[model samples]
Target: MQAECPRQPPFNCSCTLDNVVWDTSRLYLIPIITVDCSGLGLTELPGVLPSNTTSLLVKENQISDLRPLVNNEHYRHVADIFLDDNLVESVAVLEGSPWLFNFRVFSLRGNRLSQLPTYALDNALERNRHVVDIFLGNNPWQCDCLFTPSFQVNTEEG
Candidate 1:
């Protein structure tokens, strides 16, 4: 059967509803919605996403701001977000964001980030220590004294 893509604004992307096994006790199939908008040469995230989107892939784009991700209600259920090779410089927008606290996998690999808002990231990691995996590889990080302590704490605890 053909999967119906969720209703959203026009963007050069594709969506899939894959049957995934949820809890072992329940033994039921759940449709996991994944939206792929990678390598589209976009300067920012799409204005809206499907409400049921669980995974979002927007790698190799020119997106610099993360405000949309934090402000948009459509991203509330998203768990995994791949933003590798984007132009994102700061993650301060995610501070105290509910989605960040519940995220399972957040990849920012190969971005233009030099410094991080430690409190936001630290809190998110602390809250979801076992489940969340945040990738910060390939960024030009400034490991100053201010950035070191929190980074050390997360590294030691994680």
Candidate 2:
């Protein structure tokens, strides 16, 4: 089953769903195109997501792998992704999402990551990467030989 987002009034912002609980089916009909699915207690992302989505917010959930969102064509255009509080252990998950070429802002405040996963910043992704801020506070900051020893995390208010 497929539903098209109409381009007219009176029915411009309309959506369809199939028995999704826990605020999962709420962002469908809104014509905003950008949806933030953060802080909703979502263990994982819904299998069926809007193809035209430009921004996705899946912060403060139980998500450990953001690789699921990399498959869609719209994932590249996503300007901002908030993963401030979750069980994420590595930004290596970005490896799965190539469309994440030039993210304007990113947040991974609370997670299990001991240090920034410099291993994840390999080729292709390191070329056009331009993130203004990447919040890595509240995680296990271990200054060891495993991660980037020179990687200094900044947490200034913006």
Candidate 3:
């Protein structure tokens, strides 16, 4: 069974429904939703997302702020977030957010990041104790005193 994607206003994107489950008594399709909003030249993220969305792809946009992902309740269940080739400069907002500790896949390739909040990320990784894939390639990373040691530690630990 397949269900049509819900019409979310203010954003145009493609949706794929996977992992379909059919319940005989309920007569409904339970789908794992993946929302693809890549290469839309968007300045911000979509205000609304479909229920049960687990993967969100918003790469190649102009999104710089991650407050929405941290502050908004709509993204509580999202596990995989691809933000490659965006304008994200800092991930400080993810300091204490659950997304830092619970995300399965978080990609930030080809962004403008030079440094990272090592303390928060280290704490989150320690707490997670789960296998997570984090992509940070293609960014202009500055290998300075503050970043080198922490990066080495995180890499060794992770």
Candidate 4:
């Protein structure tokens, strides 16, 4: 279900329209299980979604905070989220939400995150230790005493 730019893209878009559709704010819904919206003029996610959506493949966009996405009914079911190459500076917006804990793969490869936000991870479902892959490669991880050895071992071997 992963989609990419076919030829001269943002593939589904047309250069003839002067890319006007990219400016409008609306939900891009499809019955597919995966979607890729990279290299678009998107600064934020569209305001709505279909509840059946699972994997949202938004690798390169202008999105930063995840707070706004909390209200989406399908937000809880998102397990594989590809959110690399964005403007996300901090993971604070992910806090105060209960649904984000079930996430199994969260990729933040090219953002401005200084440290992996452990606050939300600590509060995750205790029985749900299934969070497997986390990509924090390009960010500055704050490796400090507060980041005990237990935290490292509990999750993946970052």
**Highest TM-score among the candidates is held by which one?**
3
The best candidate in terms of lDDT: 3
Worst 10 residues of 4 by lDDT: 13-22
Off by over 4 Å in 2: 1-32, 122-126, 145-148, 153-158
C-alpha-based local distance difference test score of model 1: 0.80
Whole-model Cα lDDT per candidate?
0.80, 0.58, 0.82, 0.60
Candidate 2 residues 1-158, lDDT tens each?
Answer: 13533223222233334233243567444333545565666666544446545455667788787676577454556566677788888766576355556676677788888866554544423554576655677988787765444363223243
Task: Check candidate 1 and list the clashing pairs.
Answer: none
Task: Supply the TM-score for candidate 3.
Answer: 0.86
The order of the candidates by lDDT, greatest first, is: 3, 1, 4, 2
For each candidate in turn, the TM-score is 0.83, 0.63, 0.86, 0.65
| Of candidates 4 and 2, the better by TM-score | 4
Native-referenced Cα lDDT, model 4: 0.60
- Model 1: per-residue lDDT, tens digit, 58-85? 9999989888778888788788999999
Candidate 2 clash pair list: 37-57
Quick one: ranking by TM-score, best first? 3, 1, 4, 2
Residue-wise C-alpha lDDT for candidate 3, range 70-148, written one tens digit per residue: 8787688788999999999999999988777778888999999999989988788778755378888999999998789
lDDT value, candidate 3, whole model? 0.82
Off by over 4 Å in 4: 1-32, 125-130, 142-158
lDDT of 4 by residue, 17-75 (tens): 11112223565533434445566756665444334445566677888877755776656
> Which of the predicted structures, 3 or 4, would earn the higher TM-score when compared with the native?
3
